[model samples]
Target: AQSVAQPEDQVNVAEGNPLTVKCTYSVSGNPYLFWYVQYPNRGLQFLLKYITGDNLIKGSYGFEAEFNKSQTSFHLKKPSALVSDSALYFCAVRDLTDKLIFGTGTRLQVFP
Candidate 1:
């Protein structure tokens, strides 16, 4: 069994500031992690994935996440935040059954 946790319910940041949404997972074997963003009442959009290779993985919309195996964490990051970046972010990990188990979601709000 695998599960993801997003401790923050909401993250508020000013424009131009770096932002991060935390995620942690627990799984039996190799873990396949993914990040997705969703606008109001919309479907989740694929951001990035960490299946193998470099620990740091980049994705759409100038987003990146670091895969920390020892910590069992994959925290999403952005160099400089934008007001348009505000959205609901989700983290998911593939379970043994090959199903995506998603987090409760963390709402991000970027203000000018």
Candidate 2:
């Protein structure tokens, strides 16, 4: 079965600094990876995705990810961090069944 792993349970960053949430995936074939962010009381919001395109893909709210097939990794990144960006970030991959297999979410705490 395909799976994703978010090694860090929590990530702390000061406001105005850059941030990154690590993600690694395992699948049988070409992987379709995605990044989502969840706010305090809101549903998961789409951030970005990597699906047979340029290695670097950008998405909503000043976010982006790099598709590194050789490393089997797709780490989320932002040029600068904001306190409002604090939320639970998830890394997922499309499985053979077309279902999203999500990793243990990483909580991003952006401090002021």
Candidate 3:
């Protein structure tokens, strides 16, 4: 079975401050990790993905993530946050079946 858990229901961050949204996963095999952002009434937008290779992967809007195999975690980070960055975030894992299992969803509120 594959699953993801985002412990936090919401993360409060300030503009220009570094922000992180924690995520953990359990999968049967090597997982394909992905981060997606969603604004109100909009579909999710791909931020980044970690298929294979580097432990540190960078993505859109100056966001990046680190894959820790031992811990089975993939945490999203940003050196500087923005008010516009405030939105809903979802961490997902794709197994051999190529089906994405998403977290409950985390809301990031970035205050300016």
Candidate 4:
């Protein structure tokens, strides 16, 4: 079974500083990793994904992730943080059955 883990329960960053949400995945074959962000009382919003090709993939809201095969990790990153960016972030990977397996999720808090 494919699984994803978010080692951090929460990440704190000042508004205007860079922020990162860690994610590591375990899969049988080629990994299909994804990142999503959920605001308060909102559904998960698509952030980015790594299917193949480029190691670095950019997504909505100035977010990007690097696919590191050697490390088996795909960490989400943003150059600058914002108070509005405070939300719950999730890391996921596709299972052999083509279903998404998500991590426990990491809450991001950006302080001013």
Candidate 5:
């Protein structure tokens, strides 16, 4: 069984400051992890993905994620955040059946 858990419901950060959104997951076999963002009522947009290699993977909008196999965790990060970066984030894991299991979701609020 594959599942994702985003402990935090929301995260607050200041513009131009670094920000991080934590995520953890459990999956069977090879874990295909992905990060997506939702702006307001819009649908989710792809950010980045981790298929293999390089624990650190870069994504859109100056974002990145670190994949820790031992800990079974993938945490999203950004060196500097912008007001526009405020949105809903979701961490997903693709199961063997090719079904995407999403996390509870994390809402990011970036204050300028």
Candidate 6:
């Protein structure tokens, strides 16, 4: 079975500092990993994806993630944070049917 787990329910960060949100997955085949963000009253917006090659992948809004095959982890990171970056973050895995199974959703509160 394929699944993605985000153990944290929330993460707090001050503006202009580095930030990260943890993610890990299990899949039967090569996984297609994805990150997305949601603002109040809005649907999720795609941040990035890792299909193949390059364990380290960069994404939108100055975010990036390292895909670790051995550890079965894909942790998101950002060099510096912004207050506007505050939102609900989700880590998902592409299922066999091309559907996404999302985490419960992590609330990222970026204090100014």
Query: Which candidate tops lDDT?
Result: 1
lDDT of 2 by residue, 72-106 (tens): 89999999999999999999999999999999999
Models 1 onward score TM values of 0.98, 0.97, 0.97, 0.98, 0.97, 0.96
Kindly list the per-residue Cα lDDT of model 3 for residues 4-88, writing each as its tens digit. Answer: 9999999999899999999999988788999999999999999999989999999999999999999999999999999999999
> Model 5: per-residue lDDT, tens digit, 1-112?
8998999999999998999999999987888999999999899999999999899999998999999989999999999999999999999999888889999899999998
Estimate, for each residue in 87-106, the C-alpha lDDT of model 4 and write its tens digit: 99999998999889999999
Estimate, for each residue in 1-112, the C-alpha lDDT of model 6 and write its tens digit: 7899998899999998899999999999899999999999999999999999999999999999999999999888998899999999999999999899987788888899
Q: Residue 83 lDDT in model 5?
A: 97
What's the lDDT for all of these models? 0.96, 0.95, 0.95, 0.95, 0.95, 0.93
Error of 5 at 47 (Å): 0.1
Task: Give residue 101's lDDT in candidate 5 (0 to 100).
Answer: 92
Candidate 6, residue 36: how far the Cα is off, in Å: 0.6
TM-score, predicted candidate 3 vs. hidden true structure: 0.97
Say what the RMSD of model 2 is. Answer: 0.7
Q: What does candidate 6 score on TM?
A: 0.96
Which sections of candidate 2 miss by over 4 Å?
none
Model 2 residue 74 CA deviation in Å = 0.4
Distance from true position, residue 54, model 2, in Å? Answer: 0.8
Could you give me the TM-score of model 4 versus the true structure? Answer: 0.98
lDDT score of residue 49 within candidate 2: 90
lDDT agreement of model 1 with the native: 0.96
